[model samples]
Target: MAAGARVMFAPCISEGLLLRVQSLLYVGVSVESIMQRHNESVEKQGGPSNCNDLLTHSYVRRQERVIRRSIYELDADVAVSINMWVENHQSHVFFDEDFSDVDPLTLGIQTEWQLQQMIRFGNHSLIASDSRFRTTKLKYPVHSLLVINEDNKVIPVAWIVAPKFESSNAHKWMRAFYNRDQTKDPAWNLAGFIVDDPLADVLTISDVFQCSVMISFWRVHHAWHKNLVKKCVDNEMRATTSRRLHQAVDNICQQRGSKRLFEDFIEDFFDESDFVDYFKATWYPRIVFVVSDSQWGNRLYQEFHKPRAGVTMRKSKKKEEPVLEDLPKEYYDDVSAFIL
Candidate 1:
């Protein structure tokens, strides 16, 4: 366009050379394709062009090699850079740089740090955390620990970008600040765990580390799954109800020679008069859904919160053990709530 035309008219640049450079500079147009097009255009005129000398694949690779760094090297470089940044900024900022506790498992590769400044800024009193695995060109699975600050912003604390997602890696990430000595580790203490099912390995965590942090299943995901199940069940019930209604009408017609009579009877049965409050009744479930929400919740609750294989000790006496306490509300809530 206008810019290209101006460049083509430059004092030292020829129109032919400008056109060749423009063709090579297109996004996603490979050097090989550019070379082929140049060769065809040159052949139509006379012979091969000199543009291939500059736009060769080897030359492109050489240029890339000058700038590119391996992901492993980049990982180490970034860690060192962060360490330097913290050292420089710690005097001015209210941040903690106590990542000296090397995880014997990770060998201090993934150390945890906290920005205490956000406590003065963020919304929630709680520390929000989530993990991301496999985030490198090498496909090396690096589990990163991120927490929300006072501004409700995510701050990366540690990166266990090890190739595996083992229990030891997770334990190492948590164990970095597992110091009982109050003098060295006064601020770094885990109050509780708010994690999904995968990270809810609370029982197994006891073997490696000995600290009681209450683990709660992520509520949003649990509610979403329940909603999905409810939708699926509702769709199935609607399909089955329609099929059954059609079959019932056909049977009535064969017996009484009138589909209208069956339709009238069905309409009257479904009609919620002052005497028949449809919302409060459970009898309609059999004619529609397989089970009511309460019935389904009760069934699921019993199955999920089934008693573990041991009795509790009460005053040196054995007692029946109970399931998980303060179960999530989604289990027992009405199906109408999960309609969305």
Candidate 2:
């Protein structure tokens, strides 16, 4: 690598390491296999055979092929293979960071490396905004944005911040307006922006590119989650919420030379109306993923160990969970069920 680090094949992948990567780095599913699943789903949905009954030629073969290739690269990359993880429901569009598997020492390196890449060369716009949890009426609960690196550091390119805690009166009225329950999953309160170029696609790049980010940190926010109280924040006066870097980002994004998907701050999370129901984006999982351009791995292969063909997994001499043999095989039709 230009960074002066050379990776040598240390050993064959141990089943333990493979399982760790599958469960820890990737959350739990095979990125390679899942993308294959996604591509297959997209093609079918884009078909005249549309199941959702919507016409969408969104993922033609060429695009699917490109995505498939990217996925493979990530699965095989040293750095990426070592740190990425798969979470529940592997097909979800956004990936949550897996906090359990991360090694503390490398977190800084991984985070900074990724922050630099996204803010610098990866074509994207960063965003931030204040939002409320759906149930708690916790206004401007927590704000976040796609960290983009432009000045050689991962910084906010698009910034959004939540309002200070809404007054009790305001919260009551807000709940009444939305019929939200503070006890239920909170309302959706995240600010997101899109980049103007091909490389700017968030979900696509996130799955396709291998990054230096760890899976442990990106937990998905979910529906049905108790609405987190958005403790009132200090928003009386502020230059910009991109942590004092908004002006610079705005200047760069506004430049005729820079690429921007939407020229103005993304106001659609609230104004567009269709993004989600008013009940709240909270109480639901928020999928967050880091998209980057690097893929590296530290390989150390280990021998495969499993019971023989006739032996059930649970009954393997070690008494694992019973491996039922009667489950139906997943066919193409079954695989086509996840496109949304």
Candidate 3:
């Protein structure tokens, strides 16, 4: 962890634990598939970690208030996570790597692109304000990092995410406890731990809903890839984002287990353009796990979720009415023909 960087962590042990779980994945990110493979991977299962300790203190009248208050006190460069409320949070600045115009070679693990965005973060705020943004609220909290030209003073920035996370993970709870929208088939593609099977965490288990990460061989048109970069950037909230690349440093954070995040972290991107994109990518804890052990939960959040006296994450409520969902311009294409 970077000095002065804070890592905030929280475990979801609430009655709505599943909701929090759903909040972690982008639309279509599968939790059930992962669990299925987790079963086949671990042959030597041990005791499972206790979830009893995950519950918040009952003494706290407003638990949500506690969560909000926690954020208000966080220091800059703080890294925080909550398995219950939020999964991972990191902050870093990054610059593009110079690879002779050749995109960096990826490991044999095979990479794929999951998203693409042409709109910059600033303008999207208004566009996202539409009801479509409700589901995107939980999974991503990408904030832009700003610098003062005069003295180079660093300041943190933030923006609102419309559409919330509506992936398969989000629906897991509605189907389980609610019994209203369970997966079409219950036997496969489930997120809950089977408890009975213990050593099942070896395979990547990210095939079905994952974005196949691939190398980019051309100059980035931020406008064209803004959406895709933002998806990864939002997920990789903690990373360094800068214009200068350092050849001496290897991505140590990702080698151990953290997701491959850009060294650059963008709290906000005010410019709107397809040619320029900014944000960082990387995993939360940067810790590798031997999921074969039942104690995996103990380490599920090993490197994040800070409860230090002065560190936390924060959110502010706006009083505007819900944004309506109407297109700004009428299309010349025949409505019936285009509807199909």
Candidate 4:
């Protein structure tokens, strides 16, 4: 038995080294960095110096996978695991009526602490929401509801993991809060709402909360930049056109009760009737009617125009920002691809 045990253990990593690796991983050390340190330690001991011989990247990745599975049940079906978790925490977590049937599930989460924060800071204050796409391995979008705290720091009060950014999905996400039993007494009567996509979220907010809606200026600017890149031939034309359009928007937003139409302001800058018409139809109304409204204009300017540290008008920028036009072609092929 002793001889057999020795034979079995001879080719395996040392127990001490395995424990060390586990410890480092638990403290959040990167696999590559840990492997480099292991290599240095082996060299100091005058042993085989190659990390691959002892601690390969694949080995480390496997260990990471094991650790993550132990922590989060990574091997389980995502929807099943999420539903189980929600079942355990039913008081705070919420799901859509057809959660099981929905191709891409919608889940809303608010802890007791978060609910307190919302009641204290969010009531009668401007609430903001935005969605982050391709956030998880399943490529599900995370929708976040935010409010400014007493310390003047903007913090997320609730989170929604939704399938898409359509208005119907937005309605389901909003209903999670509106129908929450805990908040029924006080009710979530928001003074206003700020959202990145006015078309997707404004109507939902109006139906659910009956609040004034404001569009994030930065998101609108990014949309203009992105669309101009597609519509214009070269960078020079795009830049020139973008600058003129931004100026017109700024002037329009700054002016009180300005009757001049957005199309009229930009008509002289662009000779391309197609791009002009597209912008007019798609974006012009969103800016002029929703963002520049008298009820919300001053608040928008104060909150977004003069930017403070860590105060973003839109969702935190991802490593790769997706263009509005590219999303449908890229993601619509398999909505079920996001179901895991």
User: In terms of lDDT, which candidate is strongest?
Assistant: 4
Candidate 2 root-mean-square deviation in Å: 26.4
Tens-digit lDDT track for model 1 on 1-340?
Answer: 9998545433343444433333233112455665576456556655433222223445444434432432114335545744554454343222233332353223223121232322221112222223333244334344434444433333443344443434445555445423321224453433222232233344444443343322222232343344434443455544444344445423422333233443443465353232123212422322223122233322221112222211111222353221122222332121111110
- The lDDT ranking, best first, is 4, 1, 2, 3
RMSD of each: 22.4, 26.4, 25.5, 13.0
Worst 10 residues of 1 by lDDT: 331-340
lDDT of 2 by residue, 1-340 (tens): 6443212211233333333223222212344544454446547677323323211123223334443554453466444542442222233212222222241111111122222333343322222111221316422232222332222222322112223222222222223312221122232221122221211233432232221112210011221112111321333312122222233223322232121212232332233233223223421121111111122112111111122111112224553233222111211111101010
Candidates 2 and 3: which is better by lDDT?
Answer: 2
Task: Return the TM-score for each candidate structure.
Answer: 0.30, 0.16, 0.17, 0.55
- Candidate 4's C-alpha lDDT? 0.58
Q: Report the number of the highest-TM-score candidate.
A: 4
lDDT of 2 at 329: 22
| Cα lDDT computed for each candidate against the true fold | 0.34, 0.25, 0.22, 0.58
**What C-alpha lDDT does candidate 3 achieve relative to the native structure?**
0.22
Clashes of each: 4, 70, 87, 0
| Candidate 1 vs 3: which has more TM-score | 1
Position 296, candidate 4: lDDT: 54
Candidate 2 residue-wise lDDT at 224? 11
